[model samples]
Target: MITFAVLFIAAFCAGVQNALAGGGSFLTFPALMLTGLDARAANITSTVALFPGQITTGFAGRKNISDLPQLSFKALFIISLIGGVLGAILLLITPVSVFEFLVPWLVLFATLVFLWGSFFRKIHENPKPLGPLKAIMAQFAISIYGGYFGGGIGILMLAALTIAGLDVRTAGATKNVLGGVMNASAVLIFLFSSDVAWTQVMVASIASIAGGQVGAYALKRVNEKRLRICIIILGFGLAIGLFLKAHGS
Candidate 1:
């Protein structure tokens, strides 16, 4: 009962954070680890658990999504699909010790990228546009990362899309949709893995879906900037905590 309650609350906030600015894994992943799963298993379970909420968010934002100026939506979608499959395969073969060692650093890198993008957005109201080739490359790389770990993937996508000359709304909607696509592929691959905790996945999935709806509705009333900052703080905190855990063990 206690574990379920904790997971429910964490997943709920994760859904809200994912809807608002994309660091929900800071909550869900760690929450899974604390539930006694090892790092690799936790990561896989988190991906499966949050998938339904991601689908919901993507469907809800479909109307506002658009292709980048240089790349068609179909091309971008294909890149994400292929990248996701490759990443998931790589993850499945990775050793548990190796994954545990890498988790903190990956989270730290993602946090820094999220922080840098936030700063970049604030400093340059009209940043120079990214070239099509550069944007496509970035998307492919980030999609692979999304499939492998998927902590702050939305931040990565939003940054790439914004650099590609998209406005905030369009970039956000595009991120949500492409995120769902990447995860959909990854989930299919992860389904065959033995590491997933189906019970936690089911609990988090249902809770996150409900929370996503609430977060979508709360978008009208919430201060997005504040919510983003809170998630960033949570990301940093989780990264630090995981670093200690990894080193201590």
Candidate 2:
């Protein structure tokens, strides 16, 4: 009961965070770990559990999705799918001990990325545009990282897409779609893995969906900047805690 409660609350908050800004994994991953899952299992379970919400969010923004002149959305989609599969395969073959050691560092790196995207990226008024080939390469790399860990993939995608010449609005919607595509591939692979905790996935999924709905409704009313700041603080705190735990272990 307590485990379900924890997962429900964590996933609920994660969904809201994801709907508003992205970084749901930051919440879900740690919550899964607290439920006694190893780092690798926690990551797999979190990825699997959060997938439905991602798809829904992406679908909701579908009308706003657009293709770039240099790279069609279809091409990007294919690259994301391929990269995601490769990354998932890599994760499955990685030894548990090594993944455990890597988790803290991954979380820290993701937190830093989130921090930069949220705060610093805005400081630069104009971002240099990426050529089609460079954009494709960047998206492929981001998709692989998305499948492997997926802490700040949304922000990463948004940056890349905007630099690829899409406006902020179009880039945001396109990234959401691409994020779902990549994660869909990863989730398909995770479904066959023994690492997934289906019960936790069920609990978290339902809660997250509900939270996403609430977040969608609250989007116009809430102060998004403040919300982003709070999430960043929470991310840093979680990263620090994970580092301490890893050291103790």
Cα lDDT tens digits for candidate 1, 1-249: 787789889999888777755767768987888788987899999999998998898777777789888788888899999889887887887654655577677667766765666555576466567888998899898888788887767766765776687765666667877888899999999999899999899999998888776766654455656655654686677678768867874
Clash count, predicted structure 2: 0
TM-score each candidate: 0.84, 0.79
**What global local distance difference test value does model 1 have?**
0.78
Candidate 1 stretches greater than 4 Å from native? 96-126, 220-249
Clashing pairs in 2: none
Query: Which pairs of residues collide in model 1?
Result: none
lDDT of 2 by residue, 1-249 (tens): 887798899999877766655667878987898888988899999999988887777777677788886889999999999999887887888754544466566556655765666578766566555788998998998888788877756656765776677764566568767878898999999999999989889989998887766654554355656755654675566567657766874
For model 2, the stretches where C-alpha displacement exceeds 4 angstroms are: 96-128, 216-249
lDDT of each: 0.78, 0.76
